[model samples]
Target: MATMPSIRRASSRTTRGSAVALALTATALSVTVFLGGRTRGPAVSLSIKSPATSTISNGARCQSRGFRARAPGVSVNLWSGFGPSLGRRGLSMTVAPKAQVVELVSRVVPAVVPEDDVAIKAFSSTPSEWKGDMIIIPVYATPKPEGAEEGPNAELTGPAKELDGVLGGIISEMIGDASFKGSKGEKVSTFVPGGSAKRVALVGAGEKDKENSDTVEALGASIAGVALDAKVASVLVVSTGSQPDSQALSSGVLGKLYADDRFRTGDNVSKPVKLKSMEIEGATSDALDAAVKHARGVTSGVRLAKDLVGAPPNYLTPSSMAGVAEKISKDLGLSLTILEQEECEKLGMGSYLGVAQGAIEPPKFIHLTYKPKGEVKSKIALIGKGLTFDSGGYNLKAGAGSMIELMKFDMGGSAAVLGAAQAIGKLKPDNVQVDFIVAACENMLSDRAMRPGDILTASNGKTIEVLNTDAEGRLTLADALIYAEKLNPDKIVDLATLTGACIISLGNEYAGMWSDNDDLAAELLESSKDGGEKLWRMPLVESYKEELKSKIADLKNVGGRAGGSITAALFLKEFVTKTPWAHIDMAGPVWDAKAGGSTGYGVRTLVEFVAKQQ
Candidate 1:
């Protein structure tokens, strides 16, 4: 006996001639529509005026001055103003699903609260003029040190030399007193006696020649962690290199400075540190400023992703995940399309919905599209596994090491997709369009859950055998890949926390990547290298498909334990017909024990790839 939920919409009825038009002004976009809750409930029906033919751009209505039905979701607002007067047409239209309203509508949705805006000042001022609550100098260790009888002290050079002189040689004095040999990951912090800075620290940047974006990013992260631990509001990073990376430095600081306190209750709520501002002495160019803006956008996406992935399974169900997508579309001016269970069934998404059969939460297929006003030179599709929670279905994930409780992050792929969408939308990269899709659902245990030995058909008519219900992400992605391919995208890339074997193979620092095209893999690798996110390209051996052969159906979900990640990629490759597609097995790097929360791993790489695409 479930309680019937209430549905209330505030669109005023406007009558012209003999027809009724639903006024979908920005204020009238207040809709709290839900088809159903966790349990069964009657669907909320919506009837609007005739769909408008007007165009929608930048979240605003066009010539017709109303919403239009281009695709699904609220991309064109509520009522599309067609023929100057939708009310005069006397046409009635019925929209399914109540809550999934307003795609790319001109509405004021609450913005994602990013980490406190740490003002980054790229000043023309020299190191001598640098004054802050703390100063961090990244130093590289001596040339050779493995078997030396005594390692020589690190020399003060470049910005370190200039800043040390201004601090009355305190940095050199301390290095000598403590015998501080600058080894990688080494750190020494001390209070400044009468210097402009309250305290100073030297962070090891490894060998000078070996210094790369990863080490520099690490340096930035270390500075942020130290600044917060010391309660310093402003810090200056003295660069030793000729030109500092605005993106890498800011990303490291912002990413490391973040912490998730979502589940914290009263009294347990943790107040974040007072890190208000960071100054980089050598990043004083206009290009640097632009990079800083772009870096902030990337990290902002990362934070959004981290927050979504960090949510508990109970709090972020499939329907709720759609809600989050709708909010993102509304806030970021991205066109959105959400297909309900019925729509999915019509498209023969049995493989995707089969995984959702056991859950009370209905699967919500989400598609978010970002279109540039200029001529589209290329189109890209990004897909994510939207499993909010996975209980292993009837196969049942139970044991001492099941790690089932942590399955809330099974949706990390979807989080990364939406995170990247948020970034692409806000940054507004021109000449390229990106479509973000997620087949959001859960794999919970119930009497209705899909069982082993069940054969499910995908929309592409390809059949899948349920050999292992535990392997459900590929089932959802099977349908999503087909959907993405239909868009005729030039490139399609998907990210998923797919396998434990990936973690075993690559450890927790790098994500395994598989691609059909070598050029796409190289591009991703290059972008990842620039972003300091580790991506290891794995093999897509055609021979691996032999492992997926099923006796009754087209293929089996899981292929034994040998090369599990490779087999998983091979399975997803079946759904692709024609597209330069790449699959990322991110189970290893999705969670960083050191980052304090979800690492938001795929965001920076994906954003950089799409934003820079010609």
Candidate 2:
């Protein structure tokens, strides 16, 4: 384990409107302090002494060691990234008249794993055999013999036996007392007295046969959360009782360590977590290496999607998003075509344009293509709804029915597809062609916004009656689906945060999936299982189509409240009659309120499905 360099910090307490004296030495200089807590004055005074020498050593203590202000219980932390220098002849103090003291922090490089690389390794070894800062061992519930006593049973097998022997039968003792039944989510941890390892954790997987990729992934995530609190830099995970999915396990381990603190500032005291590496025991094979590589690729895409979704609307407009796509295409050597508003008008995308008419920002119709170096096996199209900000248009969102502030994440579908493009472009699997499409725009309120009864024509010349302007994502997707179908792909899949009904049905844990083809649906389901994303199949009930009937146009933009999600899927199905089609309603699982980050839900599933098809 590599040790991080330590920085010394110190704090002081003073009475209201008083000066705190700071003594200077040959190498040390006075540091700037901000009084936020435990101070009662609107002004603060500081006294500094000039340093005798101009140059200082690398580890010179210019600032006080991390300490609390004794006077008013305030904390003091100085910027440690700055080199030792006063650069002045006289000591001076810049005072500000404010209610609280302000602390100036120097810019320092954060200690975290690079977004593109995750350190993970797999081995076929026991936990006790591998040395690390800590070892995470998973144990599943196994039934004991009917006549067996309250002691070691025949079911004690695999790594469990080896770990029990290594711990001097502590694991068996716990099992004998019925203290560790191996129920899912149950955990027990202990410190090693004298061994290569410092600590050991036993996590439970409910049943041996019931374990899958999701179970392993969840277990690995739990381990990461606990280990981060423990501040363990390196970890070794030992899987017992059954084979765990190596990719899912590793992805979970790294995923939980992901923290987006790009905007963090001020005199915060919590230390940042920096996990160096993770090694998995009992996961040894050539396929396992490939799985780990694939896992890294998918994780990169998911991270990109989450970043895009979390970005503020002002920073991620349609034009700005196109600029990002342009850079990604250039970097990955993929073909990129960006259509401006006029170009889309020439293409007669009325339904898409109608939604854009309300916003001041110009719409961007982005198309990206990826081709393999070898012979092509199949062509696939992925379309995403890119309403960067959805304000529900003319039938404006308000009160409880409104979440206008968080509408910046309306482009979640596009973020997922773009993320997949980033991964696939780098992975470059042979014998497959993919087309990525997004009708990126905003749905804001304006005089030009489409009215509730307005009729708009799609690129396919299908007229839609706008029953609810809030249902604008489907309109944009309508034209994108038509454009994708023209590419003559073997299959087409479109994803959107289109309806609340889907969220009501599936909640935030799983995304709702609907498909016209059973084989395609089955293939995607299997791929999602491998990717560790939960997806539930939904029905495209034939009766739901009748609810979308428009007296004036070919169809209504939205159906009534009852079975609204099914009707929404039915409406999208009209645009792609020639191709095998599937619709993924990603309204739920995109934003994680509990986890406090964009879930990046569909990127891994898409990448896995496409990779297998290739």
Candidate 3:
């Protein structure tokens, strides 16, 4: 089994922070960069093949190329394509009748990491030391005098110029010929002859002033995408910017490459996740290891959440949700307590149980806790609305714009919370105690399902009139909020795919945040911004609570259509008497149809919120 590289982190991060970012000062000294045209070969496709008698230094038989198909139980990993040359077009692979070829491939590829686990050491590594497949250099476009060519001429940075000279000016020539604009997410690749690396790619990046943690992370994701296109196993990222950038780039890279192909078969399988390792050039050692560790934690957490949210409702019931939580707690060494339906009834959790009445799947009230070893500086609670499925009960969701077909993601909030739990568990950040709770269940339509106008009592002893059975998320959260408050944590935050009104208000890019506490709201905002998750604070209007006023009950589950998101927040506010609380209605961003996947949106923002706590 492969073990993590020994961390040679510098004494204190404060010392490395002064090194001024992972700035690609390529030559160790600052110099001007240029793309002046000179004689050099263009990026081209190549094919490389080896003799059958050839054997790798590790005594494993391998090839320069591989087939898309693998024998049952066969795997192709990091050492997949370390042959003499980069193969393309002509050298296609076919499935072997026997397991000999695959077995040989597996021999070269060490099973150090279980396929799902992950980083780029966000530190300096000279090109001479790397015998990797590709090197991606991110260049930003700077304004300059208009020239007689494609888009305005790019003003190369110091690192770009140094590498251009080292690579024999092929990068500059490729940029000019390809009209490479250093805009975000843009990429152009080229081949190198007698260069520092085998193949090279110059990707577009945002300007110096526009660079931040989020943008840097986006840039990293772009670099990973380009590398995947190149189909290379290892890469060296020539990082940009002049700030302390660690976790952002690594998370963005691995997160972008994340896939849930568990059920895929034959050609339906996603990419092999072939890109194994990445190294950051010219970075501080401490920052690099720190970045790798945090990025793996957060992104893996995100992948876990994505897998859950992407799963079909039937495959991820309340029982299975609790099962998954159990596995996470056991694996991460966190304390766990699962309350069954009967147990919940004894505690008066009528509001939460009401939604589960119609489903064959029993309700699971899950609590996973992470306690610091010594002094606990603070405590916080994270709750996810774990509605495995929502059929809208008597208020069957049906209309011109019904999302009932995609209701599986109604539990995105729960996915986010648990995802953050996995990350926090792995990181084990000191001095903060975190409680993760999920009231897992399904809201289905049946004779036993709660009907509209039925009154349900929450754990807090407050009555709620279920005027719209579709507003079931708030009902589940009402009980959770009350349950979270009982713990007496420093604060509480709950996420739910609770309202369509939020999607209409904020679109799919941002989560609607509602909190009465100014400090809590601001703190969360900063975290989201840093993590590259969009969040907008909606007013917790006191007057909107009138819309939820019920004649027969203390409150109605929903309010009038106008400012519906605001009223949803107000409805949840009733459960909390003290302990700063915030509600995130992440409806639109939960499931991204365009990307054809779940966003796993709240993990980073939530992790930042907890980790930043003193």
Candidate 4:
């Protein structure tokens, strides 16, 4: 039901057989072409003729000269010289329609409206034109009017709202009602549309008065999401209008497509799929080239995280996770160190080891460092709770809580940290020092599992009263945070699926962030916004710290369920000596059974924060 406008180009066709022959000979140096000629055997010479100069009349015989058939039933249509610019590759020929050179060129050229400044618009596609394989869209670029206010258009009023309503309404009608929704009060899509050939999409840079590159990137992501759902083998996105540069649009769209499929798994066969090839039309040779490369990089990073999180717990235990880190270190030139139970015992990590005691697999305290190639301005340490699987320890989860069967996502925090390290390694930012730490273990039930009411000391030698064995995330983090403090980093950030209390407070849409340092908290908030991850800063009331007080030990792991999340932060705060630290309770964002995958929530935000620090 989406509208697709017909693309138009200036008519300028020429028949130059010699030119075509020369170009073909030049191309032959780098490519091999088999052709059919007078003899039954292979032809001695092969050459292509220029496109026949004529009006694109329907069903017209468009023939080229000196084109030797590569194989039986092979046909080639030559057109005017239209090679892509340096660093930019033209759209793959596979997505082009099988027609005469004139018709094919006419159908695929850029579309422009005379004197119109709009960057995005909706067009109707006729049923006869609906090939249904893939939809090709043209995006144009328009500069925003000077003095325009910055922010999302959803925050506009009066004239802006009226204008947006018209534009949004047109887009809604083109793509169909089901393709759009309001996310956080902004118009967006729910599930990426899967049916039609490239079901409804928007091209960037329409009206000069309303142009925004950020919105253009978002539109590309939206298109990619739909492409994924449609499972089209590939997509063709064409750039149009006066915008000589449409490559940014392509990059944005490809980036989103990669992000959409990043966390997916092969086990689930029910969901809609994406196309294998994406082609961009009307892009400057340079823009098209850069967009494709950027898209591939983004997709690669996303897949890395997905693979780490999707691996089964049996294959990705604390030790196995450390092994993976060791491999990455050797491959990416990172420094890796893993502390086993013996080392942890020497450091008095009783609280962390208590959780691992129940499992046959011993815990691995992992530390990974990435130092840039210049003077280090600041050092940041990231801590992830690497609970390979959580059986709730002595406090077991049953019935609905155990339905997912795979608790491997309990190590989502660790996966995120590893993913961040991978991305940062490739990016290679300058003048920044990064340390990745993970307290990897399994919270399972066995005869030796620490029981309720037992007291254990952390790496800092601080005793903790274990009221509930299920509250084990904090037990491991307590020792991990203490260990990180010894490094004296500028900032310490820890991520964990720590408490269900966070889920109760923030729901699944946002992760609950607790930090005593305002500047660090603000920086993370900004990073979250840029990364498109939802995070809300929660209060760490001093009064809440009193709830953790224990008559027998320094503090109780569980704070009687009231302000459970805040008290958990308080318990962690006790060990962080003079360091600016933040705790991301990823309990809500780690896994979503109904959504059916790990969200990879904190990875992007954490990476963006690190990049900005440079």
Candidate number of the best lDDT: 1
Model 3, 1-614: lDDT tens digits are: 42322212121121111211111111111111111111121222212112322221111222321111111222211112212232311111111111222222222222233224334665354555567789888888664436735447455556556667776778789888977778787788877777657898888776666778878788878988888888888888764344336677777787778656655788997767778778777777786788778888898788778888888775676766776787788789999998876578779999998898666455889999999888999999999999988888888988878888898999999999999999999999999999999999999885447888899999978999999998999999988998999999999999999888988989989899999899999999999987778999999989888999999999999899899999999999999998899999999889888887788889999999998895
**Which candidate comes out best when scored by TM-score?**
1
* 3 against 4, candidate with superior lDDT: 3
Candidate 1 lDDT by residue in tens digits, 445-466: 8645788999999999988999
Tell me each candidate's RMSD, in Å, in order. Answer: 10.5, 17.4, 23.2, 25.6
Cα lDDT, all candidates: 0.76, 0.73, 0.74, 0.61
Error of 1 at 501 (Å): 3.2
**Residue 611 Cα positional deviation in candidate 3, in Å, after optimal superposition:** 1.8
Runs with alpha carbons beyond 4 Å of true place in candidate 3: 1-119, 122-125, 144-151, 239-244
Tell me which of candidates 1 and 4 scores higher on lDDT: 1
For model 2 the TM-score comes to 0.75
Model 2: per-residue Cα lDDT over 65-113, one tens digit each: 2111211111122212111232211112222111111011101112233
* Candidate 4 regions with alpha-carbon error over 4 angstroms: 1-135, 138-218, 225-235, 240-299, 399-406
Tens digits of per-residue lDDT, candidate 4, 563-613, equal 888888888888898999998887777666565465566777787789888
